[model samples]
Target: MPKLSVVMISMNEEKAVGSVIDSIQEVVPDAEILIVDSSTDKTAEIATEKGAKVIRQYPPCGYGRAMELALKSASGDVIVTMDCDATYPSKDIPKLVLLIDQGYDLVNTTRVLTKPKYMPLGNFIGNRVFALCTRIRHGIKTTDVHSGMRAYKRTLIHALKWNPDGPALPVELLIKSVRHGYKFIEIPIDYYERIGNTTLNKLSSTVWTFKRIFCKEYFD
Candidate 1:
């Protein structure tokens, strides 16, 4: 069996971090839990107690930077990235790992399978719009380019030269990996309302995702 590593980036999500950790443990018993947290609250404390390797990303760096830290610090054959807000389905993680074990290079998760009861209508529409733009501009067929939950093989991750320190880094990852000839797929999952206060700047994130969709590297 491959060593599975669950990586996440957190910021003041103390309310949901512990439950998120426990849920992952329940699904992937021996999975390595790694969190790059810049929480001002007890998120790191609770996560550490819950058996996750808590890497303190102090000064609250950008999401892309913290995510890059979590990904590069993981020590597993496969890496799964999710948010600490507990909106993603942890039960679906095993399916992602199974796909990796079945020879897929990357497994991206989608939350638009059903009409999301929890996600705001604007966000739902925004995600689909971004997905459509990506399909047209970059030729990637993923339906949820901004979904935080996804899986990546260690070799495919390290063999690439893309920087994870930009807006919508996942978009860049998908584009770069495709350029490198690696395979990827998107699997749908149930979505839920976040457990804590949302710190997301939807406007900025939206602009950045679109900017990344049309990045010059996509044509490289």
Candidate 2:
């Protein structure tokens, strides 16, 4: 079986990080769990106790930087990126790996099917607008352009460059993957309310995404 590497970026997620790691272990016992944590709380300590390789992101780097650090440290055939807030279902990991084994280069998890009521109306609208922009500008057809959970071959990282320093990393990944002619697949996954306060500034992130889309930074 190919080795699976699960990379999660966390900050002050002590309440949910341990449970998330446990869930991932239950589903993929042999999988490597890498946590890029910049938490002021015990999040890193908890993840360490749970057997996850913890990389303490010093000076409090942003989410994109954290993800980049985790990706650089990952050593697996396949890479799975998700949040450590327990919102993403670890039970669906096998299904994602199965898709990758079947020759898909990238598999993105969509939260639209479950339609959690806790999702803010502004975020829903922002996501739709971003998806529309992607389809119109890049001709990539995907339902959830901003979904956090995704799996892809580790080698695909070599073919693309990530530029966003904030929450726009997911969109940039999809855009680059499509531009590079990688096979893409989307699977509907269950969504749950997050356990702690969200650090996302939806307005700022949305503006950044739109700026990138219109300026064609994704192509460059």
Candidate 3:
């Protein structure tokens, strides 16, 4: 069996961490699950109890930083990234990793196939606009930009120089990966409502994040 490292980031996700971890273990029994958490609640305790290797992220470290920390700590050939909010289905993990075995460097969950009806309108619009910008500016076609669920070869993480410590990390990863010549593949996955406290401020965060990515892509 190919070794896999599942890197998950969470913040105050006490309510949903157990279910997410349990599902992950079911799908990837041999996979190493690492939870890089910045939670104020019982997230760490629950994750540890669920058999996940837990690491506490320091103050001011956002989702991107937490994910980067987890990636650095991972020791698998394939690295899987997802949320601890339980929005992403753990059952699709193996399918995502299977793309790596088939020679794809990176795989992103489109999640549009089963779009959540409760998703905010601005978020929906932002994702569509961002996907179009990625195609027009980066010359790569993608259906989702801010989707937290993804899988990729560990090597691509190094190749892309993806070390963003802010909310712009996802777009930075996509753009830099394209610039660095990594193959991209998108898989359909279900999009569900979040289970824990949300860290996103939807409108403001999306606008600010897109401004950063757009400016970096076009002017920098």
Candidate 4:
């Protein structure tokens, strides 16, 4: 079986970091857990003690920079990215990896499949609108453009270019990779309430997502 790497980005997610790592271990015991943390708390320490590699991105790096570091630093053939806040299902780790083994290049999880109760109403609507825009404009047929849980084949990472700077990286990567003809799949997953307050700046993230939807990378 291909080696698995579970990667996450954290910023003051201490409360949920340990539980998330434990859950991943239960599902994929041998998979390596790598975290790129920009926390001012115990998030990195807890993750390191739980056997995850902790790469510090202190002074509160933005979401895109942190995620980019985590993804690039992973050493597994199959890399699974998830939020450290325990909102995504750990049980789905193996399922995503299974898809990767079956020849898919990228796997995304859909949290809005049944109206996630934990997702705020504004976010829910915003996600749908952005997803629709991606489908119509870019032919990227994802129902949740910002879903944090995803699996990626490592080669796909090298096969594309990434310019991650802020929270809009997901949509940017999705648009470019799918346009580049990489095989993509999405599976339904449960979303739970988060373990800490959200650090997202909704207005800025929303604007960024829209900007990336038309980012020339999709064409060039």
The residue ranges of model 3 lying beyond 4 angstroms of the native Cα positions read 217-220
| Top-scoring candidate (lDDT) | 4
lDDT string, candidate 3, 56-166, tens digits: 985648767887888888888999998888889898998988898998888888765434675677667778777888788767778787778888798887655654555
Better of 2 and 3 by lDDT: 2
Clashes of each: 0, 0, 0, 0
Question: Which candidate wins on TM-score?
Answer: 4
Residue range with the least summed lDDT across 10 consecutive positions in model 3: 211-220
RMSD of 4: 1.1
Question: How far in Å is the alpha carbon of 198 misplaced in model 3?
Answer: 0.8
**Candidate structures ordered by lDDT, highest first:** 4, 1, 2, 3
Model 1 stretches with alpha carbons more than 4 Å out: none
**What TM-score does candidate 1 get on C-alpha atoms?**
0.95
lDDT for each residue of candidate 4 in 75-164, tens digit (9 for 90 to 100): 999999999999999998889999999999999988886679999988889988989999999877789888889999999987778777
TM accuracy, model 3: 0.92
lDDT for 109 in candidate 2 is 82
